[model samples]
Target: MTSIAPPRLPEPAPAGAAPPTSAPVLRMRGVTRVHGGGATQVVALRGLDLVVYPGELVAVMGPSGSGKSTLLTLAGGLDVATSGEVFVDGTALGRLSTKALAALRRRSLGYVFQDLNLVPALTAAENVALPRELDGVATRKAYREAVAALTEVGVAELADRFPDQMSGGQQQRVAIARALVGPRRLVLADEPTGALDSATSGEVMRVLRARCDAGAAGLLVTHEARHAGWADRVVFLRDGMVVDSTGEPSTPESLLDGDGGSTAGGAER
Candidate 1:
């Protein structure tokens, strides 16, 4: 009988490679976020510190309400921190004015949500081009970039289809293309594969991983060990705080075969 060997995991950093000299693409220092006030105050993140460098993908894993989504929102500039700082590409998010922050988000960041929020009325290409157009790029230029992005994510043929005309996986791919349309330095994904089947989910992970390898920084929020295996590192959060983080194992195949590591709050393993 012949035995197949398990696939080898990629090194966290290439063997004997020089350390990175550039600043992290995304950085969070002593970040915290609170909701409501007085009796209703709820802490979403508590003094979390994280950094994701170019060519790296970090997975944030925790139970529901463990602040995984909160971390992504703050990192993406969708929500402000109550205290502490978030920096993207060396610019402090807190220091940027509202307009400047909006501009920065449009030009430098990409966000993917579990809901796959493509506009129902717009075709896939138009939806992907909207951000570029809103950022003041010419319509032709934006649409050209949109087509290129869709092609990168393997969805170019569906560029003219409306949201309702595609399958869930296809819509999700379009959403990913929209996130990746511009010269984004950071990609923040919140359960990007939560709604897809196993095969489709794997495909999405491959796209995200490829983007990171191509010099973008990625922060992925996922509960599945298989998905987390795609990341270079896994951060575990509980009670709004990071309790553990570790490099991906040498044998990623083991992670999915029940040898996956644990996360904070006992939710992931």
Candidate 2:
């Protein structure tokens, strides 16, 4: 099988130039995930290999049951792969103890779930600050970071409101803010814009993109081609394997041109 190469992002660096960071923020090697046993068994992934270097935003796209969500879960350390290894910031997730893995997730990784997953009892600011607080950040500092993140997503005014008090799009922005709050090195987002309008979605993407530009890596799982266009490159999956990937820089206009690159269809989250 041929290996799929990463896309060429806009403004390519001069020839022979080294990237800012020599280490990749995330690396997946021969990863496979299986659920159940015998007749009921399901293979969610198969020998998947991926690398997201610092300052890169990679988008994952595929049809229903393509294992997009499973990929995110495994990358975020929320779920373990049946085989292979997952590395974040040069540390292998499979090699870490449960407590160490949890600590790594708190200090280095951030994840935005499709379901929002906000605590109903906590206000938006509190929801965003909870991770930082749990990571031992001072309360005042965590609250400050939370408010700043909310402002980045254009939801600063909603900081005092509970999850139930905000609209779906607003809540989605809040979830995004929570993912972006601390000094995380990698962000794994699953359909982060599913609940937002086009305008709001663009804003959220801009925030995510900006974070990547600032040296953090991001893996975005989305069904919309326009959304994927914001990424540095797009990886297409099919039947638990990477079928193709685009190497050219993608733009919304180009993706809509019908021949710009791979355009994913069928919703899977």
Q: All candidates' lDDT scores?
A: 0.83, 0.83
Tens digit per residue, CA lDDT, model 1, 73-173: 99988899999999999899999999999999999999999878788999999999999999999999999999999998898999899999999889999
**Which regions of candidate 2 deviate over 4 angstroms?**
1-19, 248-269
- lDDT against true structure, model 2: 0.83
**Model 2 CA lDDT for position 12:** 57
Tens-place lDDT digits, model 2, residues 83-185: 9999999899999999999999998998887799899999999999999999999999999999999998889999999988999999999999999998989
State the displacement of the C-alpha of residue 87, model 2, in Å, after optimal TM-score superposition: 0.3
The clash count of every prediction, one per candidate, is 0, 0
Query: Which residue pairs in candidate 1 collide?
Result: none
| Model 1: number of backbone collisions | 0
TM-score of 2: 0.84
Candidate that scores best on TM-score: 1
Where model 1 places Cα greater than 4 Å from the true spot, the runs are 1-20, 248-269
